[model samples]
Target: MQDTPSFYYQGVAALARSIQVSDKNSKFVLYMNRADYLDDFKFKKTGVNIEILQSEYYISDVEEPESFPGSLYTLDVIKKIAQAESLDEYIILDPDCLVIGEIDSRFLERHGCNIGFYKLIEGADYQFNKFPFERYGKDINLIGGEVIMINTQGAKEICQAIGSITDRRGLLTEEHYLTVIANQGKIRYCHINTEVKRIWTRMSYRNCADRDYLYKIIHLPAEKKKGIPRLFDKIDFINSHDDLIESIRYFTWLKESVLLDSISKIYRWTKNFRGRA
Candidate 1:
């Protein structure tokens, strides 16, 4: 995630909650672009081991004007950090994601590939067109970037290959870059079996099971700003490991709020129904 301080608190809360439910052996690291932000940040008391790294490496020199400068630096920063620690493998997650169930390491280990990413059937074209793939003689796949597992050695090779592209037309978006690299036979697809779902709107909460253990990852990218508090409330309620009454109350209120908004839109549309027609 980018260094958006406004969402830091919520991001940490979600991270802590994720740690609580994740595999006992799994390690976590949070990379922040700013160093001073660490002074005021406080992690929740989840007892799960987590490390914080302030990233100094950047891709500003290679970034395209239209793209956010920080976008391309994520993988670079991860590679640097992994190399520093001599880590063989690591998983990268967007801070807005919540781990609602145990992440079986075996799932990643069984692949025995250099990189692992979610494979989406429908969204390939958006990433495919962004790269000069003809130069690399590789096709594209829709590799979801929200969460990825990286084999350190393969990442180094891919990063080196990407860095050598001198005739680049534009900055390679991270997902597309990974897709290109993976299509070169260096990537493995993690088939999570519907365990991961993206929440784009208030309606998404309705799909969340009352039981946290049912889903592996609940990605809340759209809800990073205003929705975190309500989500924190829901997660806090759920983490108590009690009955669902409190969470139901919050969800009920949320559902009604969405319904009311929909009704208001309908009413306004009807009130002006004849004006444009």
Candidate 2:
């Protein structure tokens, strides 16, 4: 099988570990504003063909103009750099995500969809109050920027559009900006299962399962009250091998083959009870 093309931020050792365990052949491209901080890492040894690109988007964590000249600008630059890279498709994962296990590359293939993202919780809102409707001018639900997989054409389009926007006050965050443009064009978009949506607030895995679909990805924050990672933090909820594989297979496109049945059935049975009341 061919390797999946992926990207991550600097200092995301945990995410890198997950990626390595998922598939030894996957290639990862990391972005950093300062190359010196990540010079010590060896991507090839870790099962990832690492490419450290210069980041135009970075800050001392949260030091900035509150919103402007921070992640927005940084992500814009990253998008541009990503566009310049050559790859069949690329998944941009935040530094805080945990891969649990390898994902079937077919799911990430561009099915005529320019972008792949998951919907937010039904009632709660974080980035845009109006959500996809407000940002995209349509009534579709909103998606997060945490785990984004884009085709090369989509990458270049998003990069150029984001680069053209010079003001921040009037616009939402970078994620919203990218989705908004895609929406305007009615870009062929794909919706991941609700299981992949962020489970930060009162949302739980059981709650997600109630929707009858699984999420191959979930977005959690970095900061938190009383040690709980925020929706943007690099922490994860999956803690075992089965959890990893099952999570990756949620709403999966890969056929359930011999490899899947080979995993412990005990874990599969137990998964039903997990995240449940």
**Model 1 misplaced stretches (Cα beyond 4 Å):** 1-3, 44-63, 81-89, 121-139, 184-195, 202-213, 232-277
> Positional deviation of 63 in candidate 1, in angstroms?
5.9
Q: TM-score winner among the candidates?
A: 1
- How many clashes (backbone N, Cα, C below 3 Å) per candidate? 0, 14
**What does the lDDT come to for candidate 1?**
0.55
> Model 2 residue 110 lDDT?
34
lDDT of 2: 0.48
List CA RMSD, all candidates.
Answer: 6.1, 10.9
Error of 1 at 220 (Å): 1.8
Tens digits of per-residue lDDT for model 2, 39-100 = 45444443444445454544433453344334454365446645565656667776545554
